[model samples]
Target: MTFYDVTVPISNAMITWPSDPAVSITGTSLISRGDFCNLSELKIGSHCGTHIDAPSHFLENGRTIDQLALENLIGEATVFEFKNKENIDVSDIKQLRFDNVKRVLFKTVNSSYWKFSTFKKDFVYLTKDAAQYLVDKGIRLVGVDYLSVEKFESQLAETHHTLLRNDVIILEGLDLSNVERGRYELIALPLKIKDGDGSPARVVLKST
Candidate 1:
């Protein structure tokens, strides 16, 4: 079996979404410095790096990260390779047969932009129609290789609301550059923060 790590390495220098909290790692004690043990302090937004967004992200009374089911976090997932499309549309997703698809991950040009030092504002994102389409298709989980699943200037915030309202687990900041579109076993586990709207996750894929 081959295992592909889809999560990005979180670090203080890693590029994050604009206006989001910056990641900081400070070593309080180090064995190299003759200290008892190495202890580091980590500070960052819950939504940083490879993360899972719960319903509370967009809905005030929605479910929190800890409330998500483990069954939804681990399952058979399909990776869809999208190109040249500024916004993923309902028509685009309609062509694919989502039968037995528990989770879906989109690999787009947005994954390529991760190579740059700075964050790209115009990365490919899901449109409102696409979000509704996924929800309508009974998709339990949706993953994207960018900071957000929705476009930057989305006016309706429909993409988020539509998915979250339906309890669709949203995974973002995935590094899918080396991955190809196919069926894979997905293991995406986020931090069990109490009542957290979202939390960073370590996602991995394995061929069955």
Candidate 2:
């Protein structure tokens, strides 16, 4: 009955992808200032910390966040740990068995980047070939421990395209540093934004 809350906390200080809007929070109303109730305003990108990338994130005619099926967001998942790998490539993908696995989360060295004060440009990510392998194997959802599933500054964004074009859900910015490699039930619920390409999500894992 144990649960793992793998979502990273959102804050103005949290590491964000370069060029993306930084998180901003301000107290619009405060009891200390004689306001009846405390109210805060938040300004954040749709692709902020701990989020899901809808197919529309890359595909021109793909489904938006609200249109995504809940069946794909909540289900059995497997967390796999990779050690000493710069990126998850075809060779690394070949070592695993996907027999009945629909959702997979990769816990890599990137998880340690969460402890740093800044974003690590060299964080571990998924290569295009590895992404294609997963799609070929019929993976419904893919999760990673960084802001992006693809290599930073990738010009083509091939990894993202490979998965998104096939309707595979991409979950990113996960704090998998404390979670062990094993099977669990994944519950990732994103804000139901209309025509949204991406949205931050509250992700949790329950022991199966």
Candidate 3:
């Protein structure tokens, strides 16, 4: 069996959402420095790196990250490759086969952006209609290669609201450059932060 670690590595210089807190990883006690043991400190946003967004990320009085169902975090998932240069519209989503699939991940051109340390504003994202399509198809979870599922600078945040309100788990900041289109067993576990709207996750895929 083969496995793929789709989670992005957290680093002090990693790209992040414009307004979110920047990642700050510092060595507090290092063996090289003659400390008792190697220890580090991390100061990052809850939504840093490859993370899962719960309903509380967008909806008021909604479930927090720790409240998300584990069934939705681990299961068989289908990966769809999208070559669209712009947003993922309904047409692109129409090509997907949603049968018997509880989770879905999109591998798009945005995956290429991971090579750069700077955030790209024009990365491909999902359209509101496409978000509704997934919800209508009974998708329990959705993953994207970039930092967000919605288009950059979106004032309404409809894509997030549409999915979150329907209890759809949003997995973002995945590194899917090496993954192919197929079915795999997804294992995405986020930090069990109490009252966290989102938390960084270590997402992995095992060949079925």
* Number of the predicted model whose lDDT against the real structure is largest: 2
Q: What is candidate 3's lDDT per residue for 1-208, written digit by digit as tens?
A: 9999998899988999999999999999999979999999999999888999999998889899989999999999999998856889888889878889889999999888988978899999999999999999999999999999999999999999999999999999999999999999999999999999999999999999
**Predicted structure 3: lDDT:** 0.94
| TM-score, candidate number 3 | 0.98
- Clashes within 3 Å, all models in order: 0, 0, 0
Which of the predicted structures, 2 or 3, would earn the higher lDDT when compared with the native?
Answer: 2
What lDDT tens digits, residue by residue, belong to model 2 across residues 78-170? 999999988999999999988899999999998889889887999898999999999999999999999999888899999999999999999
In candidate 3, stretches whose alpha carbon ends up further than 4 angstroms from where it belongs are none
Which pairs, if any, clash in model 3?
none
Scanning candidate 2 in windows of ten residues, the lowest lDDT window is 110-119
Q: How do the predictions measure up, each by TM-score? A: 0.98, 0.98, 0.98
Root-mean-square deviation per candidate: 0.9, 0.7, 0.8
| C-alpha lDDT of residue 51 in model 2 | 99
What's the ranking of the predictions by lDDT, best on top? 2, 3, 1
lDDT score, residue 80, model 2?
Answer: 97
Two-way lDDT contest, 1 vs 2, winner: 2
